[model samples]
Target: METHTELVEGEIDLKYSLAERVKTLTPSSTLAITAKAKELKASGIDVIGLGAGEPDYNTPENILKAAAESMEAGFTKYTPAGGLPELKNAIIAKLERDQKLTYKPSEIMVGVGAKHVLYTLFQVILNPSDEVIIPIPYWVSYPEQVKLAGGTPVFIEGTKEQEYKVTAEQIRSAITEKTRALIINSPSNPTGMIYSEEELKQIADVCKEADIWVISDEIYEKLVYNNAKHVSIAQLSDDAKERTLIINGVSKSHSMTGWRIGYIAGDETIVKAMTDLASHSTSNPVTTSQYAAIEAYNGPQDAVEEMRRAFESRLKEIYPKVAAIPGFNVLRPQGAFYLLPEVREAAEKTGYTSVDDFAQALLEEANVAVIPGSGFGSPDTIRLSYATSLDLIEKAVKRIDEFVKTKWQD
Candidate 1:
């Protein structure tokens, strides 16, 4: 027997390497901070994690019961790659009921999660160097997914002066011949700012004129607060509907993050392509999850409203406290469950050079974890999710308040 080995026993071979596509992907700062907080908690520390985007609530009992029934009824086998027709009908009913819009079952594509659905969409739509316009302070995954599909992410700054929302003019200005799509996230992650109806119409007009696709991420649609409403760009016009693809799921609204069910509603061709890609990539979403989602959409929605009210209450109670933190200039968010404060002044006043450093110090010293805005393309700010209990949210804000006070240099 010949022992043929060109490498040392403990040495990694140079021939095996990760693909270049994955090389540019950045780790999610929110998950990284959440994991560190968990580590601290595991080691007997009381770490308050405001970094996670998921609701602290459990999946509603009705949904859970439905999932159990599905398994009991022998629904553990593989389902169609697109989803059960029943689930698709429920989603169709939801759109018609909520937005006065109609979609055929052929236009709905279900996947593992909203995140996965978006990844699939990008894969099917983007070609090499096609540009997608992403507004600033975006969900961390948007740009990365575009890049993964060989698309370039072109950003338009949604400065705090504009309530962290890009206008139609901004979108129009950023469009180039390479522009293939634009992503709009109302009740947006990190900021929680909902765009007005007029804003949507103007943006729809721009997309219509430019003849580009609009990817409206309405995952947070059900969580609007203080009388604010969510208007889908697709609802603006038939032309707008034709150009828009809506991505949503039960994760936030139903607290079903772990259930891993999300879907897309759009042109039949696009849905078909995504479905074919999913058949090769995921085969199908979890069988029980699809059943749970059918119940999520078709079942009574009292739990959804109750959770929304709870989040609203928490937001109202915590917003003032978070805003009162010295050097933290925060706008009162109209929707969703996060408070994004421009903290560059806070960082500078506390002798830190960057918000990222300030956030790190907060996790270590104050035992409070927050996602730095650098990950969201807003380097001067930080994102604090209020999806946790009111007590924990209050305590976390208090700790942050004291940390800034203690560290203040001027």
Candidate 2:
């Protein structure tokens, strides 16, 4: 046997080498920021993390009870690769009840999470170099997942002036022979913007004419606030329903992020392809999570509404305060739990050249964590999640205000 130094110096080291595909992938910026904050907290630093996308609320009690009962009854065995029948029925009921959209059992398939569902969908739909239209600023995962499926992400800008929503004309302009799909994340992550019903109708018309598939990510649907309503593009018309894939889960609404259950509802052929791919990749969403999701969908939704109220109250309370920060330009978000504030002026005033550098300094100096917007394709902005408690949100914002004021004065 060789000594450690000989082993290092002598032979080929294939074990540590990454696959080319893996090398090209970027780790999630949201997760990276959260992890660093966690590391600092572990090392006895006082870090207030506003970077995580998960609700600070615990998984609802009824859902937990359902999962516990499932385990006790030996429902711990392997389930169908797509999902349990009971859970699928619950999802079907949810669609008809909430969106007035109908989906057959064959048109729905469950996956480990919305992220996994999206990955599987991309895998089944994309060919190498096929282009998928994505609007900026997008969820960090959209472009990366498209690339992972050997698809190119063609981005159309949704400027702040447009409320961060790309128009139908923008979508029409991006389509080409290679265009295969377009992703729309309403009540979007990082931005909290929702496209109106009329906007969806026009966008759906463009997709229908251009023969492009629409991937509607409505994960934050339940979290809409004020007068905003989340209208599924799939509900626009029969033609739109035929062309749209709906991705959703209990993660946001039921606070079940760790439960790992999400699903896709779409055309039968595409759903079958996703199910078949899931059969190989994740086997099935965790059996317990499936059962819990059944209860989450079928159970009384008071808890869901309660959490929504809390988020809405917090959003109303904080938006004005955040916007009032000197040099920070933040629009009042209509839905979701995040605020995407353009901080380029703030950064410059604080003597930083970029928002990324300012975010780094914020973490080091003020011990507050926010995701820099470069990861979301908007380099002038930063994302701050309000999913945490209103108290923490207030404290974090105060720290930010003081930090910016002090730096600007210096």
Best candidate (score: lDDT): 1
Clashing residue pairs in candidate 2 are none
Residue ranges of candidate 2 with Cα displaced over 4 Å: 1-16, 30-32
Backbone clash count for every predicted candidate, in the order shown: 0, 0
Tens digit of lDDT per residue, candidate 2, span 42-152? 999989888878999999898899999999999998898999999999999999999998888999999999999999999999999999999999998999999989999
TM-score of each: 0.96, 0.96
Which residue runs of candidate 1 sit more than 4 Å off their true CA positions?
1-14
Q: How high is the CA lDDT of each candidate model? A: 0.94, 0.92
Q: Model 1: per-residue lDDT, tens digit, 1-410?
A: 95647888888766676789999998876666677778889999989988768989999989999999999999999889999999999999999999999999999999999999999999999999999999998999999999999999999999999999999999999999999999999989979999999999999999999999999999999999999999998998999999999999999989999999999999999999999999999999999999999999999999999999999999889989988999999999988899999999999999899898899889989999999998899999999999898899999999999999998987
